[model samples]
Target: MMRQWGLAFSFLISAFSGLASVPPDAAAQDRPAVSQCQAIARTLPDVVYASFSASDVLPAQARAEAVRITYLGHSTFNIETAGGVSIVTDYNGWYRPAATPTVATMNKAHSTHYTLNPEPGIAHVLHGWGDGGGPARHGLVVGDAYVRNVTTDIRSGGGVMEPDGNSIFIFEIAGLCIGHLGHLHHELDEGHYAEIGRLDVLMVPVDGGLTMGAESMSRVVTRLRSSLILPMHRRGPPITAFLSMFDDSFDRSYATGPSVTVSLRSLPRKPLIHILQGV
Candidate 1:
């Protein structure tokens, strides 16, 4: 059922543009129910800066309503939804929360980005790359969250372009669209953007060299214009360089801790670069 739509979307990508596209099935709302993030197009204003504490513990009322995002270092993040569904993004063997994640998504760009052997308790393990020679397709509702992916190419060992080698996983939960850019190696095109749709929070790779250059990556950020940008796969100077590109137009914020609880009501009025403590 879900796989059919995913496969159809994959075929659409191959048949038309080399880039991924949102399938008719998804556009027709035949799959995992549509979310507010996809339904509403938010136009946000420009710059402001603020420092705040991103508490690990959710407030009483928010505990059953908001989405908790915790940066576990590198590209791995533990995203916990109100419905008790936990998802780990770029799930390598290390850098995870104490409890096992209900859903684990992995990319195979490097060993740090994924692991072949995930823990036994995980209910859903989605690979960014496909089994044989096809795009990794995912569109499903797990608990209260809707998860899907848009495929992208990756740089292989010999510098060849491996089609559909990576996936940008989008999670619709707590009325927010959260996207994790997995080991992304190239700049996205119009079709890719169209497939991705709206994102409230975007988890991106800021390692200027390993993924893509700051200039190119920043272009994608500007186009997406997500309210909150969470930078991952960061090293020393690249993080500074990446933020500098948006300094004039985007607000910058430093979180006291690794965790932040976000709901539709909590999104920043202006676009912000939220730097978590560990990453």
Candidate 2:
């Protein structure tokens, strides 16, 4: 489905190219300090460096001042909250996509949902509980940002007993609490729902084909009652279905901007549903 096999060789070329023409091991001192968070300018203001290497985990970035959200197509997202918490969700984005991340979230339940190679410099890498039920439970705090993992129910093909590690992330940053649902295969039960309380921004998968259908996603957004809803993973019918739903529920407006960067100081004003035109 995605040309990931080529990315490794390409990564080596890109990594070493940035390092000088030598064996990468020789340039160990020039590895970009992947263990720490270094703020780099992207189209968004405060994106940190992280890698989604598929086998390794990143350290963590502390002391972030702003949060910027960039849609890397499909379900992949790079989020930097004003408090300096950087998060990447279901990182199966493009190979050489313009932006890398500081922290990446990978869910192994579906092939299209997760990718190999996070951005070149991100630190922490988190995964949801997968079908095999491995390495899904994780918790980390970066500066004032607190990130925790919560596993929810999965019923593939509209709630079948697939036992996937669908993840719900809680980000406490900038006096705002936002959550991203990574390839969710089913609706959240009571206990699962209870853990994801008071979400200020909700990143959801509108595409019903890979994850849950539109009705289930609608129920999820309603259940969370988030202040802002950012739609992802819905490149096909899910986008149409999600927009139709949003148009009916809230004053849906297409955003002239790429992302809706919000801080707590600007929140508690009524909820606004923004859809990006160029995502």
**C-alpha lDDT of candidate 1 relative to the true structure:** 0.77
lDDT of 2 at 226: 64
Regions of candidate 2 where Cα sits further than 4 Å from its true position: 1-66, 83-85, 93-100, 116-120, 130-135, 155-160, 238-240, 246-249
| Clashes per model (N, Cα, C within 3 A) | 0, 21
Candidate 2 local lDDT, 1-279, one digit each (tens): 134435433453453245335433443333331111111111112222112121121112211234677666666666776545567777665522354555677776666667665555767777676534463665565544556667765555654565545777767554456678877777776556545545667788887656777888887777666667788776567355776654444545677876666654444344556666554
User: How close is every model to the real structure, measured as TM-score?
Assistant: 0.80, 0.67
- Model 1, 1-279: lDDT tens digits are 455535534443342232114453354354434433332121111221121112222233432368999999899999999889999999997887999999999999999988999999999999999987889988867776778898999999899999999999999775567999888899987667767767879998898878898898898888788888999999656468888888666899899999988876678878889999887
Model 1 ranges with Cα > 4 A deviation: 1-32, 35-64, 236-238
Q: Which candidate is the best by TM-score?
A: 1
Give all candidates' CA lDDT scores. Answer: 0.77, 0.58
